[model samples]
Target chain A: MRRRLDMQLDELNELLTHMGELCQVAINKATKALKNGDVSQAKKVQKADMKIDQIEKDIESLCMKMLLEQQPVARDLRQVSAALKMITDMERIGDQTSDIAEIVISENITESMELVELTQMAEAAGKMVKDSVRAYVNQDLSLTRKVIEADDEVDRMFVENKKELVEYIAKDKGKHGERAMDLIMVAKYLERIGDHATNIAEWVEYSITGIRIEGN
Target chain B: MRRRLDMQLDELNELLTHMGELCQVAINKATKALKNGDVSQAKKVQKADMKIDQIEKDIESLCMKMLLEQQPVARDLRQVSAALKMITDMERIGDQTSDIAEIVISENITESMELVELTQMAEAAGKMVKDSVRAYVNQDLSLTRKVIEADDEVDRMFVENKKELVEYIAKDKGKHGERAMDLIMVAKYLERIGDHATNIAEWVEYSITGIRIEGN
Candidate 1:
């Protein structure tokens, strides 16, 4: 029975890693679509979000089953519960990426507007997502901290991007206010994705140390 | 043992009600701060958010304890799991309310701009929160549907509010663009609160019928 439980835990880890990869793909595709003004790619991201949602439901059911069958305790219990928590954040990352794609597509934000800062923000947030999942899969505390610290850079980029967008709107004398707002919303979504990544890292820390970090 | 589990479930319900009340207070205080442009109220909302966060952690720990101690199955297990899912959304509602309050305080939005649509949106969102909690506590499927249906009105108000803000910015020709953006963001937060409420209602429905309603 112990070996079976161990095997189930390993399966859970593998599933979470798979879900994390899908999230990375979703975010990357959404941001790339925005950069290239690829409407089809944006649509593809939206479609992929359904798969992420389905995977979350699958993972949740699996966790419930494990708890029911094994009645896990101590560190095992924490690991299962933490996975339950982590998947919610991962699902939100997928949703936020889809939201970004929706904004990009609806606004018809073609290659006209400069997206240097927003792209950097996306890359930073995407990296955090990838690293946070890696930290969990490997139980790497240092990588978890790195993911947490990366949130600061994502936030700084958001602030800087907001300022630049505001200046652009002012220079256009409100003519491009709508476009500027869309860009700001995109940045905000990216920042939120970074936050969800940080949340996943914090959960990973809790699973490892049995100590919850406050205000990550 | 069954009786003890039932008693613990009762306690969980009471705790959830208390947390829901705190969420209501946070949203009300944040919206009130926006309406009156009262920085102190905004600060108060921010402080109250910490209390909400603390309560969520407490509730989560209690849920874990119940799961570990009782090993509940079937309906009882569903109730506990639903509570676990509901608290995350509730906590997010608090965080988003605090985010709105932060914008209200930092922007120093004085009592100059007309805020009729936003006021309506806040009231609608607040109702959804209250009704969702009531549905969960009472297991009222009809009330859950009511809460879910009300999200449409909140969403419509967001669109209208966005249009009005854009027009207001255009009239000022970017002079008050920053302020306009803040108002739009406030509306967006309210809309998100409504979404979270809808999520709670959906979870309530799941607890009752085991049928997940999509796009509520």
Candidate 2:
């Protein structure tokens, strides 16, 4: 029974890692589409979200099965339940990535927009997602802490991006207000993705130590 | 065993209903703050969020206890798990309500901004939250469907609000662009609150029918 539970836990870790990788790909695709004004890549990101959603369902079913079959106790139960919680956050990351792609496609955002802070925010958020999943799979407490701390950076970038976009609109005399608003929305989405990553890290900590942080 | 489980489930229902009421109050306070430019009310919303978060923790502990002590299976297990999922969305509703209030406080938005569509969106989203919780507590499928359908109206209102805000900025020659952008963010937050409510309704449906909806 112990070995079987370990096997199932390993499988759960793999599926979660795969889900995290897909989110990273979607974020990367969306960011690239925004950079190059590539509508096709944006379309691909939206299309790939279906796979992410499907994987979430798969993970859910597995968690349910583990709960009903293994009746895992203590740390093992925490690991399974935590997977259930983590997938929700991972799924939202996929949704937000698709949302960014949709904005890029619909807004027809050109590569000409000065998106320095936005790009940094995307990269930072994407890394957090990756690191959070790594922490979960490796059960690395330090890496989980790092992911949580990194959210402050993404948030700072979001605020800085908002300020810069507002200044850009002010200078442009509102000629580009709609476009700047779209960019701001995109930044907001990235910030949310960072938040979901932080949530995933917190869940990872809970699974490892059986201690849920307050106000998460 | 069955009677004990029933008693525990009733307790869970009471806790959830209480949490839902707190979220409604937060939403009402935020909306009032926006409409009246009441920074103090906005601050109240922020302070009240701690209570919402605490209630979510309470619900989580109860669910874990039910799962462990009762060891519920089949439909009973589904109900317990659904409660687990619903509280996450409920907690998010509280967070989004607080976010709207924060925007109101920081942006110092006045009631004279021609915010017809935003006001409409807030009312509609709040109703969806209310109806979704009612549906869950009553196990009413039709009401769950109603909440799901209401999301379309909120989505429509969001689009209309965005278009109107953009036009308003254009008319003001970029003078009110900052304020318009802030309103747009507020609308987006309300729209997300509607989405979370829809998710809760879906979980309620799952708890009732054991048929989890796809692509929630």
Candidate 3:
């Protein structure tokens, strides 16, 4: 029974890693679509969101079954519960990526209008997501802390981008103000993705240390 | 054992209801801050968020204790797990409300710039949140569905407000364009609050009926 539980836990970890990879891929595709003016690529990102949702459901049920059957306790139990919480953040990452794709398609966001800070922000946020998942699967507290700290940089980037966008709109309202607003929304979404990554990392900290970071 | 489980479940429900009320109050305070340009009111909203976060910690530990002690299965298990999921959405509602308050404080939003649809949107989102909590506590599938459907109206309000803000920026690029953009952000946050409320209602459905909503 112990071995069985261990195997199931391994499966849970694997599934979460897969979900993380999917989100990273979605973020990449959405960003590339924005860079290349590829509407079809954006559509693919939206379509891929359903798969991410499906994985979330799968992970949720798997966690439930482990609780009902294995009835894990202590550290084992923490791992399962953490997975339950982590999946929600992971799902949100997918949803935000889809939102970005929707904006790309609707606004006809082209390569010319892409803000340099926005792309860098996406890269930072994506890396955070990847590292958060890695920290969870590896139980690496250091990696988790790194991911949490990286959130500040993404937030800084967002503020800087917002400032630039505001100035751009102020200067060229008739030309690209609407598009700048859309980019602001996109930047906001990416910022949110970073937040979700931080949440996931925090959950990993909870699972490992049994202490949630205070004053969140 | 079953009686004890029932008692603990009741406590969980009551705690969640209390959390919901806090979020409702936060929304009210944030919206008032924006309308009144009372930075202190916005500060209150930010300060109150810590209390909400503390309550989330309480609920989380209680759920963990129940899982470890009661070892609930079947519907009782579902109730416990669903509460876990519901609290995340509840916590997000609080966060989004805080975000609105932050915008109000930083942007110095005032009654003069308040869009008609934005106020109405806040009201709709708050109602959905209140009703979603009621649905969860009452196990009322009909109310859950109602709250879920109400989200569409809130979303429509967001889109309408966004369009108006875009036009407002285009019309007055040098004057209040930045404020208009800030209002758009506020509108988006309200829309997200509505989304979180819908998620809570869906979790209610899952707890009551054992069938998760599809294509969310």
On DockQ, the candidate that comes out on top is: 3
TM-score of 3: 0.70
lDDT (Cα, tens digit) per residue for candidate 3, span B31-149: 88887778999999988887888999999999999999999998889888989998988888888888888777777444554557888898999999999999989999999989999
Model 1: per-residue Cα lDDT at residue B45: 94
Model 1 steric clash total: 0
List, residue by residue over A1-216, the lDDT tens digit for candidate 1: 457889999999999999999999999999888888778899999989989999999999999999999999988998999999999999989888887887767765544555888888888999999999999989899999999989989988987887776676656634666777777778878988998999999999999999999853
TM-score of chain B of each: 0.95, 0.95, 0.95
Candidate 2 per-residue lDDT over residues B86-147, each given as its tens digit = 99899888988887887778775545456677778888998998888888889999999999
Give lDDT: candidate 3, residue A108.
55
Interface RMSD of each: 3.2, 3.4, 2.7
Candidate 3 lDDT score at position A178: 67
Candidate 2 chain B worst ten-residue window by lDDT: B107-116
Candidate 3, position A34, lDDT: 77
Note the DockQ of each predicted structure: 0.21, 0.20, 0.25
Give TM per candidate. Answer: 0.72, 0.69, 0.70
Error of 3 at A16 (Å): 11
CAPRI-style grade of the A/B interface in model 3? acceptable
Clashing pairs in 1: none
In order, the Cα lDDT scores of the candidates are 0.86, 0.86, 0.87
Error of 2 at B135 (Å): 11
